[model samples]
Target: MKKSYSIEEINSYLNGELIGTTTHLIEGPEQLQAAKSHHISFIGSIKYAKYWAASKACAAIVNDNLTMEPIDNKAIIKVKNADLAMAKVLELFNPPAPEFTIDIHPTAVIHDTAIIGKGCKIGANCYVGKDVELGDNVILYPNVCVFDETVIGENTVVWSGTVIRERCIIGSHCIFHTNVSIGADGFGYRPSEDGRGLVKIPQIGNVIIGHYVEIGANSCVDRAKFSSTIIGDGCKIDNLVQIAHNSVMGRFCIMAGHSGLAGSVTLGDGVIIGGSASIKDHTTIHSGATVGAGSGVVGDVEAGKTVLGYPAQDARDMLKQWVAMRQFMKKQ
Candidate 1:
């Protein structure tokens, strides 16, 4: 059920200064164009503020830096950062997650040698293979599979149809969305001795994921050829992303949807990969580097640099090149 809060209560929750008065109750946050009279919205920029006069939102969280003439009837809560404040408001109205039974379901299959910790909830049709160790309060949804010798830490939740392959080590407070695949064999092939066919190199390594990692649906983390494919703490991988074999992702890295890292690619802390970006094999992206959407990175990126274009280069250089090309085209 949806909950409602008075304008004053919402203001207090945000710790923002209330600019105007409203008796209305805010049930949820909505987009400015789609907001109803009972909903709240945010104005984070001048582009969005233009829609405020046409919006029906009962209250709005406005950026403190933006100057807005007070409307007659609507309530305005001014905050330092409107976007961040709206995230809190959304959490306030967020509903509870779907409840699974507290214990292991009868329909699930568990190997006798598997060690399941206290308060672990294994849903129907799930399979726990030999020597698997699951920590306390781990929740495995239906149809999930854990291969032999895998270890998952406490308070991890894996949604339906996810698979954790052999010997993978997953840390605490991790969330894997539906259809995620962890520790799949790396793409390693070489010409056979006969020189007629490709020979598959054995992928003997496991994946090591640190705490507080969240992998979105359909993403895959491939196992290494020898050591480990590592995902550091607080990494967030979006849907359809791929982390290839031996790739090392540092702490708090964010990979957007469809972004991929080729084999042996290394990323330093706080690297942000935009949607559909592809990093070439053996390339290193240093700390705080940003890869623009649709860019193809074929080489190393230095720290704190933003790269763009197909063969990704510094963002400013790419922009200047585009401007030069445009000017040359006019001479044709």
Candidate 2:
């Protein structure tokens, strides 16, 4: 069922200055162009100022600096930051949570030695290996597998087709999306005695994921050869990402889709990696650094710097090189 909130209620929730009628019922949020009556839209910049007049939304969230003519029957909520305020409004209209019965399904295969905590929901076809420990309210969806001796903390959710390999330690409130493979064997090979073929190195280590971490669909975090591969608290990894053996990611790091970290890579707190970027093995990305999309990072990235392009360098230098190359191409 769709939920509705009055303009006054939304304004109170957002702590925004309300203008126009406070009695309008807002059903949901929509983009400026698509918004209709009873829907709320947001304008964060003057670049979108023109859309405000044309938007049919009964209410609009606007930045404090945004200046626009008001339309009849429409309410305006002026906030210091429209984007952040819109996030709150969207949450008000979020759909209901999924209902999972707090019981182990008959089709689930749980070892006798495994410890299941209170309020956990082990779905059908799920496998809990020997000595595995699941904390309270942990939900393992159908086909999810927890390998031997793995420890999953409270309120964690592992979606269907996800696998948590042996000895991995996952903290509370973490989310592993569908098909995510945690603690998989790392890519480590050595030359054979006769040099005819490669010999695989045994991956004896595990993965440690901290509280409130979220790994998106199909991403993989490889097990270490010696010590644990660590993902710190509040890290958000996008779809199809790869975190190789012995990698250590600091708190609140963000890695976008298709980005990868080679073996032993270290990311300091709050580092941001753009989509399709690749960080070579043993490199360190300092705190607050930003790596642009499609870049190849071969060396350490200095703190707070933004790098871009193949063999990533300072973004400004890369831009200048691109301009120079374009000019040379035109001359030819």
Candidate 3:
């Protein structure tokens, strides 16, 4: 449960208007519907001002331009940007990061040929294969198995049960959560006389994850065929995401939860793929293209385009189609 804060106190905190002990409390706007006497909610637009009186929330954070009659029991905090104020509230409730302790677990089996750097901590039941190189202060949690010839950079952290397959090259400050699989074989099969014959082609290449890349829990990145499966610097991949063979993503891209990209797809810098987006193979998506949630991209996407819906039309076309579908349903 979240700690409570009065609306007047929240407004004071957001506007830097008051220096009181109440700024330490944390609450989200959605919680205001169920919040007790001390909970805080936000009213960013005049459109949502109608909900103000109906909300059980203790306080309302509103934009400066909204002119609404004060609720009988609710307090109001006025701010220039309510969205940024939400970020500040989240920061106050953020969890602390784990620190690197200089101790390797005795249950881990490290090859004598491997080079482990100073202050690195290898966890229990872990396997460090031959010729593996770990940089300074790397932390591998319990049950992590890194195959031969893998290289992890300084200050990187691999969580429990993560498997780094053979010949993987990862950069500094990368974080791999539990059960993340790197360098796994890509989907390659040729249909046969017998019900689509399942033939397997070996993934001969490795995965190259650049600096500050974060792969969430249960995410699997397939190895390449001839080159590396490259994730550029500062790319953040959400949980259960699948990145197939030879996929090259440029810097600072965000792949939301459950999104899957087929083999050989190339994404330019800063592309944003929303939740559950599916991009077919061999397609190129230019920089700054925003693929909306549940979009199915079957072809190349131009730069600066926001595509949505199945087959992924332009944003305008997608909206028009939605309007038509709703009208057709009414007629029926």
Candidate 4:
């Protein structure tokens, strides 16, 4: 079981009012009908507030202004921001995994020129190529492969089967899950002199990942042709996301699962790309912009605007299209 906290403690941490305490167990509304005596839950959004009446959880962190008809057994921890409270709770409960010993497994093959730092753990069947530099407390899980000249910073963990190519620089405290490949060749093939053949343009660049980034399983980020492909600090990238060559993602940008960015795309700070959103090459999403699910962004997005749909335009346009489609379907 994870760490437990009293409602009082949690509230104090979040600067909220605490009513009770719960053990370290928690789950979403759909997962648990009734919270156990130790269950810690959350109620931030109005959508989730409806479940408060039926919540059997012992304690919850909620908004200060919200005044729901309180449940008999439920203890409400009122805070200024529920999301921030949840984040703190998550940090306390699900802290980073303990670092393993700095032992290279017997089955692993490390090249003579590789530089493995102190307290790093190279797992079984892993391959570290020549000139790769791993920082202190780095963990390469079983069967992971890192190519030559890669530089991984301190306290980073590369999960199983992940492949990082040459010259990629990953910053400290980053987490990369299974099959995450960085600095791979970009889709930079051009037409050859003979139309029948395709010419491969050399991807002679690297990927630069900033500190505290978390990349989910099977995500692939490609290298640029002449410059670096960049993922900025504090970015969280979900599974199967693809960032093409020369793409620049600003700090705190969130990219959901299956999102794809074509070559040269730029996302400003706080930009959020929803699941399955595919941004076209050369597109620029300004700071605070949001892209809706399955958006095909092809043009520039202004700050704070939400875009959706193919040849992605403003969210208003997408809403009109959705209404028209619904009406057309109903008529048919």
Best candidate (score: lDDT): 1
lDDT of prediction 4: 0.86
Off by over 4 Å in 2: 22-24
How far out, in Å, is residue 264 in model 1? 0.7
lDDT of prediction 3: 0.84
Cα deviation of 59 in candidate 1 (Å)? 1.0
For model 4, residues 106-154, the per-residue Cα lDDT tens digits are 9999999999899899988999999999999999998999999989999
Per residue, candidate 1 scores C-alpha lDDT tens digits across 51-80 of 888888878999999987557668889999
Give residue 135's error in model 1 in angstroms. Answer: 1.4
Worst 10-residue lDDT window, candidate 1? 67-76
Q: What lDDT does the true structure give each of the candidates?
A: 0.95, 0.94, 0.84, 0.86
RMSD of 1: 1.2
Decreasing TM-score order of the candidates: 1, 2, 4, 3
What is candidate 3's CA lDDT for residue 311? Answer: 92
Tell me each candidate's TM-score: 0.97, 0.96, 0.81, 0.88
Error (Å) of candidate 1 at residue 277 is 0.7
Worst 10 residues of 2 by lDDT: 94-103
